[model samples]
Target: MTKSLDAHYRAVVVGGGQAGLSASHYLQKLGIDHVVFEKNTVAHKWKNERWDAFCLVTPNWQCQLPDHAYDGTDPNGFMVKEEILAYVDRFVKKVNAPVFEGTSVTSLEKVGNLFRIQSSAGSVTADSVILATSLYSQPFVPRAGERLPEGITQIHTADYRNPAQLPEGAVIVVGSGQSGCQIAEDLHLAGRKVHMVTGNAPRCARFYRGRDVVDWLADVGQYDITIGHDGMAKKKHDTNHYLTGRDGGRDIDLRKFALEGMALYGRMTGVSNGKMLFQPDLKSNLDGADRVYNGINALIDRHIAEKGIDAPEGSPYVPLWEPEAETTELDLAAEGITSVIWATGFTPDWSYVGLPIFDGTGYPVQHRGVTGVEGVYVLGLPWLWTWGSGRFLSVGKDAHHVVDHLAAHLDRTRRPLKQMANG
Candidate 1:
């Protein structure tokens, strides 16, 4: 049963995903009077949004909570959806967090020295606010999709469950990111003909030598590196490298799928009259993805050589197949494409917060989750502090950092900001 929130708290944590729950864990340990306001239930997105076969993209060992790391036997193996949710459930129980599930914070504004949060239940005030809401809350579908004939069914990746759920005909999948390529393969494996549009998203091998590529990279101190380490803060916006944790873990080779009869094209420019128009960059896109796959393997090889590590010898990835000719347009009706899946991606929705902490693009301007505002912090967003800030591998660490800074601020004042505000 959910608990009714009090009129006030020393701190308020928004969002109930790993980020919020992790913050709750730290706050509880320090005996801080705080409440976590979850718009939905705990682990809401993980429970509802993921597909049937969805599993962790990284290894299970990466599932680090505040103190309760994954104790499951298969540290190297990835947990499927059920196991993933169970893990989160256990963490919630372990924390014994004061989480107000199903409460939505509609708006947030600074009232004098205190923070006033307008919520679905009513209003509340707090000395400090921690936003654990991530940026990928809203799924995006292009408006040009409206031009498609009504006969064809269109859905975003979030809505995709299985091939059997779709119409019994060839499916057109746009955007070759992790979701796009994986869903295309899922449909193709189900004997559904897939007409896929490629994007510039890169690919990497799941295992290069003896262990998972992530294991190798972690050994080389890659995940520990902060965002913008290579002068590429933009890398945060780059699509995740195409791979899968399904059936343990493995690489997702789009070229191999192409060789197996999946029709590949470049980006979908628009729908003209009744046909789907595409950009003329299929060849370059495929080549670029392959280049990244091979490059990652090369880096692993260099690491092995430098450390004199006894690992299996490896070589660059060889393309299984290539486009014989560029395909710039697709006739949906002629090709019998009855369904279209837009695996495009998502954007953040932080408009509820009435604060001047956002940039021109509306992204929060924070340093390791600390906003310029004295009593507010943002956590669990991509590139908030590092490459893994929004990922299971690093969200807990990021949460700890946020809570530590917030705890110190409260300690220094030795009184609630609301008390100061009233005076």
Candidate 2:
């Protein structure tokens, strides 16, 4: 027989990161009683990110909650991983929302418009379930990753801390996202001969016209990315959005590093005799990334023009770091690279939830935040709506919308039926 608990809540939000905390804030604003289930400590990922040198892509001005904004030394300053985690913790404590930290939800099953969530601490039934887990939960490493020669050391970006933690010698950094680029930069700065395995080198601006790129986005209402369909759709194309290099307004550039000696290659194929082999798709992927960057710039230009703002003059386009193509296998022993950092991306894994609502890709099928199975909702998912809701600050307003919708649905759907025993 299943066990039972006396206490009950109107909703249960899983994960206490930015998304979950935002959701809780909104739930309270609407006077909806809810409990948060965090598998690890609050801001678990950010705390563990201790990745020697990690910072937010978006600036501090954009790092905000509904009415609460980041008030610190520099409003336009970029935030470090530790600062971001501390911000989340402070927000939770400020709200005084009931959060059950270190409690992992093992399974969530839907029965008659009421979802039963089973966790290690205990079980609770709520009218709605909010999955605040983001895309960073599951690291997306290729199948060939497992087959690499045993001599090479491999570490995922999630597990990486600093250059000191890596194996001595030349280092290979995989994936070209913000994480990958930052990791490669860190390793290279540590005087380690670094080889960057290129995937998609998207264009990124460092600062825009004397301020952080995030400030530019905010000034142009781009930071309020949560309000429009164009913003939402643009975010969906994640692979294209955050392109590499420096911002249009900054004199600094990443091309300097690539030219300095970061060996760029196509994607990795497999390893043989402790030698790493790469495929020929590197250039093409980079080309695709270029197209995406251009598209974003074009979109931003249009937005600025529509708002009748003075266009900042200068080379908006950052020069590409074109690498010479030479197909060859690399032997680590000769190169002296003891550690490999996998800057590969992340994916959402909802396998433990056991929910009936899922698409062909095993992702939850929902209209907005509502799932097909009643009483089940999802929050904090990147690009959950059109644009703003997935990112940290952008998700706040969206979370409010979700809470209101859920509150109405709960009142309308939930009846005076007997509560099932918690298991």
Best by lDDT: 1
Tens-place lDDT per residue, model 1, 1-423, is 347868988899999988998888888767789988888888888888878888888999998877888999999999998999899888878887788888888999999989999888878999899998888788899888999998889999988888888978899999999988888888988899999999899998898888899999998887888875778577667788899988888999888888889899988899977799999999899999989889888888899999999998798887789788888888889999999999999988797899889988888888889999988999898877777888888888888888888887997766533211110
The TM-score values for the models, in the order shown, are: 0.95, 0.86
lDDT of 2: 0.69
Please give the distance, in angstroms, between residue 222's alpha carbon in candidate 2 and its true position after superposition: 4.3
Residue ranges of candidate 2 with Cα displaced over 4 Å: 1-7, 208-212, 218-237, 240-254, 298-312, 316-321, 414-423
Q: Alpha-carbon error at 111 in model 2, in Å?
A: 2.5
lDDT of 1 at 90: 89
Candidate 1 residue pairs that clash: none
Which residue runs does candidate 1 get wrong by more than 4 Å? 416-423
Residues 303-328, model 2: lDDT tens digits: 66788767674344655686567555
Estimate every model's Cα lDDT from 0 to 1. Answer: 0.86, 0.69
Worst 10 residues of 2 by lDDT: 243-252
